[model samples]
Target chain A: MDNLKIERTKSTPYIFFDAASGRLRVEGESYPENVVKFYTPVLDWLHGYFAEGADNITLEFKVAYFNSSTSKVFMTIFDLLEEYVTTGRMIEVVWICDRDNDVSIECGEEFKEEVEQLSFRIEAC
Target chain B: MNIRSLYLEEEAVLKRAEGLLMSQQCFSLDVYRELYEEYRKLLKQMKTLVNVADLTQAELKTLSEELGKVSRIDGLTELYNRRYFREIFLHTWQQAVEEKDILSLLMIDIDYFKKYNDTYGHLQGDECLKAVAAEFQRAVGHPEDFVARFGGEEFVILLPHSDAEAAIDVAKRLLQNIENLCMEHSASPFGQRVTISVGIACRCPTSDVKPNTLLDEADQALYKAKAAGRNCFKLYV
Candidate 1:
């Protein structure tokens, strides 16, 4: 699988997925006007990576503000990672936010609570 | 998966469960139990996704409304800012033209504002501006009257459905209110205290008249007021 990199815009976040290192990073605010249109390629890329029988992957999210649609998309992402972990694959998810951002912290905590197999951590920077 | 595909996949899972139920007699108990368990897990995940989307959407909507209100108001004096004034004033003017009703405008300027700022500093100047703005709000009691901070050391008031006589009365009341504030302005030449100059313009707006003409007329009157004296009102012909 090849690495994927999508630049951030005023409305959408930056996405960087490294196939060699198994490191994925999403940064910036995510409030795209068309959430599905913006996220379809990213989801397709993830599907390709997982189908290649990837052994270990680490995903980090440093999002500032995300609308409700993006929140649902994140849920979908978490479900995919959890599916891989159940199949004996090593998958790690990290949520990074500012210490003073109560909303972001709460969101990360809620995601951590819902996941069963994915190793998740919330880090304040 | 994307939102559309995610929902489609959920529907497909449900159809698979339905298909298994239709061929129930053909399947062994262990196989049927495993299929049912998988169906239940998929349903649970779908439920979680919908719930999170709904909750976050409601939160973002409220935040967006609050930001809309904040954008319309001036940060310092809590009065309507120039941008909002420009929008609403145009709307009000259009309404006046349609109804053939009189519209009055007031352009107000603080006398010796630069001197006052030099003596008391910017912090106190801001306080003085806030105090004057508060007095304007109090002096204009009519529901039809609109007040806004035009810019630094300048303010504007719109009096709808009011003629020149009524507008003049409002101007007199405003002058008295500011004089009563008695916020000492040692730097001013007018009575050794803060004072304002007022310019009034009234028109029964017509569709043919440009909207900015009223503003220009009031500004001219304000110039005349400043020329006559530091603390007085002038009416445009």
Candidate 2:
């Protein structure tokens, strides 16, 4: 499968998906002017990559802050990951948060609880 | 693996996916690839559209709060308007109680301002308002100090951690600043220059005492300053 790389913008996160290495990363803030317009193509690439399944994969999320709109989009992404885990895919999802931002830490924990199927870890970096 | 290997292998994956080559998989790789491409576009678009509608509902909650703030500023003085003044006054009063901080309120009025407006015309009255507002804004150097245009010819200054002494000092300096500007007011009462009257009230505010308690005291003191012949300040007893 092809790799996907999206550059960071002021209101959106940096996204990188590598099918060969089985690694996915989203880093930076996420509160796009139009969340749908910004995340559509990237999620499309992710769906395609997930279909071409690998045995083991990990997605790293290091988001400083995200609006509620962006969180819903993230819930979709995590739910997709959770589906793969339920189907016996080895998926380890890591959410890295800054120490000062307790809200980010709490959000990661909430996602972990919500997506019970995926192996989720909230690490304060 | 290290990031370099991951990146290099990604380039290799792109090479294969680019060639339109079919890999060994569960079923017809060509058919699966075509189906995945077709399904990916629709699936993502559908998911995102559903979420977008849900997001706007939540986004509107925060949007209204921001709009409230933007609308709370006075157009002429570029200072907070009366509504936000009351909001912040309550907020600061609450903070003072929580942190055991001193809070002070200053009610300022331009002496014989109606006469100044009548003598100099409304345009110059507007110019005077802007200049005075700017000067007061400049004088309050602390980031937390709150200032608002209370109404015509009146402004409020809130100093959240200051005592009566500090408030008096600020009032004195503001008087000196206006005196130095020497804006002409040939109407009547005071001298040839425009002057101001200030009233101050300070306390470690608590719920036992309302935000209005200090405002009323400051207003009373302002009245006293006006009665004591207009160009000075009085502290609430």
Candidate 3:
């Protein structure tokens, strides 16, 4: 599978779903005009990755702010990772937040509580 | 000469009509003609008024359209508003059902909000709400996710192509982010720190599950979170 890289804009975030390194990194703020229209392709890529049997993935979320629509997309990514973990593959989620920002830390903790097999950790940057 | 003659002619006609009505004791053709002319004049005046009314109606419609464009807030809290959320939710739900993608929802609420409002006034309470809202907006990080301010101090996040466990994880992260804020809420039931409770629900777009039902399930989980504690999250069974 080919690597996917999306640059961040005023209205969107930076997305890097790398196939070779098995690292999916999403950074920046996301509040696009049409969120569903923007994320359909990203969801497709995740589906394609799973179908191709790519294992040993690490997902990193380094976001300052995003809209409710983006939250749903993050759920989709985590769900995919959960499936892979269920199949006996290792999946790790690294949640990065600023040191003083309790909001980000709390959000990371929330995501961690939901998943069972996937390893989840929160890091302050 | 012309003005004098015209005035004299009108007066003569009026006099003749009165005379005919009195002497003939019957309605004449000339009287009918004069009445018809008066009726035509009134009709023309009414037509002009009607045209002005139509113009005012058109102007009002244009003003309303302009106001809608300027006054409507598409997204609040840096997330989608209820209006945008409903549109995307329906669209994504349909697509996920058709394509067999994972779909999920998370309902989030501020813990001890009433206490917060009591301790810090509604102004500060609103500030806290805005801060948390910004955090939720940042969490999704993708276009596919839908985050919306469901109501005061409450938010809903939609995750497509996700499962139950992942949805739970996201909820946990949101809780952690808010907790880390350390926004002092002395009146809170959960201690000095302000926190949130989240409820999560996920579906694979099965034939049995509808979008509203999924939301209801998530809301139930949110209720469970509130029941268990003010700062925890739960996933629907």
| Candidate numbers sorted by lDDT from highest down | 1, 2, 3
DockQ score for model 2: 0.03
* TM-score pick, better of 1 and 2: 1
Taken in order, the candidates have interface RMSDs of: 3.3, 11.0, 33.9
State the lDDT of candidate 3 residue by residue for B1-237, as single tens digits: 011221233455567667877886778787788866745533443443344334445555877997765443433355566776777788898998889898899999898898889889998987898889878877775677778888788889999888887787788779878877888988776668889999998887766677789889989999999999769989899
Off by over 4 Å in 1: A1-12, A15-24, A30-58, A66-73, A87-90, A99-102, B1-8, B14-39, B118-123
TM-score of each: 0.78, 0.53, 0.46
lDDT of each: 0.87, 0.81, 0.76
- What clash count goes with each model? 0, 0, 48
Relative to the unseen true structure, what is the C-alpha lDDT of residue B52 in candidate 1, on a scale of 0 to 100? 55
The collision pairs in model 1 are none
Q: How much is the TM-score of the A chain of model 3?
A: 0.92
Ranking by TM-score: 1, 2, 3
- Give the candidate number with the greatest lDDT: 1
Query: What DockQ would you assign to candidate 3?
Result: 0.00
2 or 3: which has the higher TM-score?
2
